[model samples]
Target: NAGVTQTPKFRILKIGQSMTLQCTQDMNHNYMYWYRQDPGMGLKLIYYSVGAGITDKGEVPNGYNVSRSTTEDFPLRLELAAPSQTSVYFCASDSTGFYNSPLHFGNGTRLTVT
Candidate 1:
């Protein structure tokens, strides 16, 4: 299984710009999630999807959006990038029926918005 994969491992954006962070998994997981990790901080959930066409906002969904149209893809979009949005973004997923299941994270995309 390839787990999760994110593109553009690093990025620098100016304020007000927009970008999409791509996420894909080959493990055929039914639950996928997007999270942001500020410097020295724990992961904060941004959005999640239980399955295709079923998505929900999370703790920190502001300035972001997500769509899960298939079991293998769940991409996150930042509408208007801000410095406060500058953080390491991670894409994760886990098997269904395992509420306590640990997430499989991608390498992470380090974003810096100035």
Candidate 2:
């Protein structure tokens, strides 16, 4: 089964432009998340959803938004992209909580906002 998938392996955006990073999973997992990883650091949670139609903001949710209308899709929206938002974004899923389960991650979307 496909765990999670993210599109646009790499992208370069100018300041103020917007883009949505796509994420989809086929594992039927109840938990989906969006995270950003800087050049040399661990993943920082951006947003998450417990299930369809229920979304929540995470640690670094600023300048970002998310929608969970379907179980398989949880796209992250960057309304006004800034240089500070430039990082590798990853989509992950977990059948259970972090304490009991490991997350499955996509290759990642490398975004560069100038």
Candidate 3:
């Protein structure tokens, strides 16, 4: 089974265009996270969820939104895509929210907005 999966491996959008970056996992994880990494920078948390129906904003939640309606899916929405939003986005999950739990990361979705 796929531990985690993300769609649209690459994308390009106009300044105001919008899109959804889809993420799903088959590992029955209780915690999931969305992160974005800009060039020469570390990953910044965008949003996260502790379980189905429970989500919270993360370090950099502006310009984005997330929902966790099920244990298998957590999608990130770009309301109005911007040049600053151009970054590599990743979705990760762990069975538990413990510090020692190994995270399963999906292949990143590279987005570029002009």
Specify the highest-TM-score model's number: 3
What do the candidate models score in CA lDDT, each in turn? 0.93, 0.93, 0.95
lDDT of 1 by residue, 1-114 (tens): 677999989999999999999999999899999999986789999999999999999999989989988999999999999999999999999888386888899999999999
- TM-scores for all candidates? 0.95, 0.95, 0.97
Write the residue-wise lDDT of candidate 3 on 11-44 in tens digits: 9999988899999999899999999998778999
Can you rank all candidates by lDDT, best first? 3, 2, 1
C-alpha lDDT of residue 3 in model 3: 82
Candidate 2, which ten residues in sequence have the lowest lDDT sum?
94-103
> Number of backbone collisions per candidate, in order?
0, 0, 0
Candidate 1 regions with alpha-carbon error over 4 angstroms: none
Can you rank all candidates by TM-score, best first? 3, 2, 1
For model 3 the TM-score comes to 0.97
Backbone clashes counted, model 1: 0
Q: Give the TM-score of candidate 1.
A: 0.95
Model 2, position 51, has a per-residue lDDT of 94
Q: List pairs with backbone clashes in candidate 1.
A: none
Residue 92: error of model 3 in Å?
Answer: 0.1
How well does candidate 2 match the true structure in TM-score terms?
0.95
